[model samples]
Target: MSALTDNTYRLLRAQVTGATDRIVKLALFETVSEVCRLSLSIDPPTDPLSDFAGWLDDDQWLKNHTLVIAGTLARLYAMPKRPWSDIDTARVNKEQYDTLLSYARADAAEAPNIDPTARLLGSIRSRLPGAKDSQTRLALFDVLQEACQRGRIWTELVPFRLVPGKQVFSIAQPGARIVMLLNAQHSVLGMQALNYSDEKIAVRTDIATLNPADLLYLTMALAPSLGADMENPATWMPGDIFASKYTLLLHGVLGAMMLQTAKPYSNTALGQYHTQIYSRELNAAPLTDRDGGLPTRQRWRFPRFA
Candidate 1:
């Protein structure tokens, strides 16, 4: 490796390893918070599907995906880990497993390899948003059911597609370099679009200006390894969770890169001041207001693949 590249890799390894303790702690807190948020709404019997349906609108697709993601995350982070959980051992399709495994291998080495799983994931993700795909629909339902039992969130490996046209251009398979799109609000820029054509795999953004809530939300959404209470650790294992962790790290780096691209801000100051201000603003702001900020609370819209 070139001296520059080698130096950079060393730096990243140091950073990730150094923060492993923090990541584990932060992930635990996040998992608990999501559960608490859900608990506040759930009634006796705790029918998560019903609770989910009531909490969300008619957008079943997005609801299914989000619930599945949340559920899977919860399961992964569940305390006192359940080792024999079927959710963790349920056989993944051979082809799909192979594809993701290959991607994972590539990711470890930081190699650029084509990932078939990306195509499948993109297709499902696209369809899940609104397309009437029975498999996608059923899979999400199954995932939700799994979540109810084990608190696991199911995820698929997919390719980063071009926006507008939503065409699959390149896949950030395992080990492939990735870029982050969203700021703290999960407002993703068209990084996939830009990466499709160039060697670059990130976007330009004002991370220094990002609201802290947005960062927290982004952290929740981006960190794949982080989970809520869903199953026992022995059942799923740390290796199983690392993939998600890597993905989240990539997203975090993307956010950091965006800030770097903008006017340089000391990392220390960005974490302290900007994050605090953003957090206060987010906490103070209303999620929604009906009648154009009138007294009535506006209904919350669950975002689908849109």
Candidate 2:
């Protein structure tokens, strides 16, 4: 049952009928995987799913994740020069297929606030060589981490109190991760790390400096939300930073994918298509929510009561 049945091929073909042509099962099979990989690269799943061949035979995957199959059909039927190609009908299928992807992406927004790493990984794999290679995941992780760092603007109000007459005070969280202290007006506080090792810092209060009287809270340029291991698919995505902005990861990879010399996924268009989307999403995103998008302090201050 792990192979596409003749009935399945016929079912897929029914959507793109042609007098002079039919999609061979083998060809369709390959197309199914290509579409699946590309689709996943666009929006990664939090939990790992079956590979393309197994999913083709999986009743649940076919029934629930129909976009993968629909996308394949749309490509073959609409991509031009095929005997069975029909741009008009293919447009309809492609529209429906894209709509499904959109819906799934929207629904994913409601799921647990996980990292976009797993999703980004799938995306990187789809566009480049070494789809599941470890080195590739790490390299792409660096790409994702860089994006996260640049976009690392989130706040948390943890256990911190100004000790009067003291130049230094211990932070509720580590000093190395803290970006800066913020005043109540959300202005960066002129504070310096006295000792990152001790997680202590000093704040300057003067005519030219912001006041700690209404000291806002902690800001972090922390590492992505994920477990220690990069190899684990389960731990691939970090927390909220990516859940909603998962598409940003897609955009990032697409822009980067253009630079790749890899076939099939490569494009001569370079980063034009990808860059706009990446910047738009990254710039358009409001600073991550104070609580949800940032899980670092909570993990540190409130270790599992579980």
lDDT: which candidate is best?
2
Worst 10 residues of 2 by lDDT: 297-306
Cα lDDT of model 2 by residue, 1-306, tens digit: 233343455566666556323344444555455544544332232222334345343433432234555566677777667678788877766775675566444434543443455555554565565444665655556556656445543445553445456656666443224433332223554333222333455555432344446543554434434344666634433344444455566667666656567645566564565565467555533333344334343222211111
TM-score per model over all chains: 0.17, 0.43
TM-score of 2: 0.43
Clashing pairs in 2: 41-123, 44-119, 114-238, 115-237, 115-238, 117-237, 225-238
Give the least accurate 10-residue stretch of model 1, judged by summed lDDT: 215-224
Mind sharing the TM-score for model 1? 0.17
lDDT for predicted candidate 2 compared with the true structure:
0.49
User: lDDT for model 1, on a 0 to 1 scale?
Assistant: 0.29
User: Candidate 1, which segments miss by more than 4 Å at Cα?
Assistant: 1-46, 49-55, 59-72, 84-306
RMSD of 1: 24.9
Per-residue lDDT of 128 in model 2? 61
**What shift in Å separates residue 35 of candidate 1 from its native position after superposition?**
7.5
Deviating ranges (above 4 Å) for candidate 2 = 1-120, 123-129, 163-166, 170-176, 180-200, 204-216, 221-238, 262-264, 286-306
| Model 1, backbone clash pairs (residues 3+ apart or across chains), number | 29
